[model samples]
Target: MQGLDEQPVQAHNIDGFVFLYSEAQQKRYLSSRKNLLGHERVLEQAMESGYRTLLPLQFGLVIHDWESVREQLTVPKENDLKQLFAKLEGYREVSVKVLWDQSSELEQLMQENAALQAERDRLEGKNLSMDQIVKIGQAIERAIAARKQAIIGAIQETLNPLAIEVIENDPLGEDMIYNTAYLIPWDTEPHFSEQVEALDRQFDSRLRIRYNHLTAPFNFAQLS
Candidate 1:
């Protein structure tokens, strides 16, 4: 929550939401990661702090000097940062990861994927053409893609009503369907988490729903 260089790394309070970052090292050593205490910890500290609102900087962001921090945070981008901060002042951020069990999902999919199975059976004979095989492969890929979209879509539909904003993050692994961050009002966090807990129970059989961490509105502010 506090230094990029040898100095202390406390995040600056800019209108309750914007936090300016200074320069960091070119290489990331274990020592440096330890110095920053890892991104999650830093973010957690900021959110838990007494600040009315705090904007998180992206991982490994740095400027050449303190001058850059002051300049970029204050006068840069025609003060769009300030405007964004003002817009985000009363909200906070939370991480929610939705992971499906590939084996279980795959099993369910296969039972429902008769066309894909038919294509596979069609390819078994040595008489198959290369173009046919390629087409079958593409078909399989399309089926999987469709299933993933369906699963993530249902999840999004379940939560979208509660979120002020939601940003999709890159999936962490093959089983990850959605790695999302939500912008929620500070007072509404309990209801948000309650909904997540219900989702966890509902998806217990096939998906792992993790309500990860609270942090500054990094995703909402487009910090990463």
Candidate 2:
């Protein structure tokens, strides 16, 4: 064994003897470490030059022409190489497993989004049906007709003073009419119920008398 300080400067076989360098030399090598492209260039150049470089251990100096110097550079048996290849395959499997898990999570999220979109579309369709403008128009027409008939019947029976002209019989429907205002006096309002009751007894089956007294422009007898 040679002392650390007195070790031979030059190595006999680059592969057989491990190169030992000072701390300063190690730092210099670290600083000179090549990038990916530089390393690829170095490998290509070395292959063309018929030289192989190898680092024995982490702290060992780089050895050029390792095959010429070291017997260990001799190719191993097929089975030995296969076992090393299997270890690398195991590392690849672990990486694939991690990626597959992430892919599964993404697939689940995509399915959930699709379901939400479908539900939203269904709700939108239902809302459109409920708020349909044609349906609203039909309902308004029916309500107005029913209210108009009620007003007409109430006027005929409750204030039977004179000619109740149907001057503007603009019926929105069979039951509803527009511009069917009455002509009745303010004083006859006290006897309004007696007149309405008399009409009710006579035409109760034929007409409906839903009366709400309203202010009129003229007397009941004058309009008649």
* Cα TM-score per model: 0.73, 0.21
Instruction: Put down candidate 1 lDDT per residue, 1-224, tens digits, no spaces.
Output: 34444444554544343554534565553446565466556556555766646555556654555557666665465367666768788787788888877777656766888877766776686687889878877877777789888767777887777888888889998888889988878788888888888877876677788785477676677531
In model 1, how large is the Cα lDDT of residue 145? 82
Question: Candidate 1 at residue 65, lDDT?
Answer: 58
With a 3 Å backbone cut-off (N, CA, C), the pairs that clash in candidate 1 are: 2-9, 2-10, 3-9, 22-63, 23-63
- Which candidate leads the pack in TM-score? 1
Q: Give candidate 1's error at residue 104 in angstroms.
A: 4.1
Off by over 4 Å in 2: 1-168, 176-179, 215-224
Candidate 2 lDDT:
0.36
- Taking the tens digit of each residue's C-alpha lDDT, what string does model 2 give over 1-224? 22123333343433233343322232224323332333333333432343322222232345445564344432333344334333322111000000012233333434655754354445553645645546544544454445445545555444434323323335444433223344333344446546655755764454444443432221211210
RMSD of 1: 4.3
